[model samples]
Target: MAEDGAAGGRPCPICEEPLYKRHCKYVCPQHGVIMDCADTFWN
Candidate 1:
């Protein structure tokens, strides 16, 4: 079976672990929030 949330198995950016879709954002351990990535893509 496939993993939850993501179509493939991808870890969080901050935590480098599985991403958890909490509330309305993709939360990570080290990064905390993975949202607004586009805004900081170049930064």
Candidate 2:
């Protein structure tokens, strides 16, 4: 099993908020609103 970094008091890089798992990755409102898994982003 992987470790939850935020559980140890880590903050998201951009928003500096507690990161919660949204789907496959962690989400910070200002930082990760764009899902990194997608291929066509601007489209």
Candidate 3:
């Protein structure tokens, strides 16, 4: 089964680990927040 908030199985550019969706952004556990969403600008 897939993880909740997982970013469509996309790998992190820094560590090659799976990215997770959190706070409207993609995060890498090892690297912290990796990418942010456009909606984040309003939050």
Candidate 4:
């Protein structure tokens, strides 16, 4: 899996909060938020 760089200003697709690099995925701490990176990046 290609690693996404540090998501400094990248907002969470769900909570709208800032995103952070977590392993191979961008994770959100605001549980229950459906954050699809692919969909978010395209839109």
Q: Which candidate achieves the best TM-score against the true structure? A: 3
Ranking by lDDT: 3, 4, 1, 2
Off by over 4 Å in 3: 1-4, 39-43
lDDT of each structure?
Answer: 0.52, 0.49, 0.72, 0.55
Which stretches of candidate 2 lie above 4 Å from their native place? 1-9, 33-43
- Per-residue lDDT of candidate 4, residues 1-43 (tens digit): 3245455655676778767656435665674333455655534
Which candidate's lDDT is highest? 3
> If scored against the real structure, what TM-score would every candidate get?
0.41, 0.38, 0.62, 0.45
Error of 4 at 42 (Å): 6.0
* List of clashing residue pairs for candidate 3: none
lDDT by residue (tens digit), candidate 2, 1-43: 3254343233566667765555445566567643332535422
- Kindly list the per-residue Cα lDDT of model 3 for residues 1-43, writing each as its tens digit: 3455756555788889988877657788899888776755423
lDDT of 3: 0.72
TM-score of 4: 0.45
CA RMSD, predictions in order: 5.4, 6.4, 5.1, 4.7
lDDT of 4 at 3: 49
**Backbone clash numbers for all candidates listed:** 3, 0, 0, 0
List clashing residue pairs in candidate 2: none
* Model 2, global lDDT: 0.49
RMSD versus native structure for model 4: 4.7
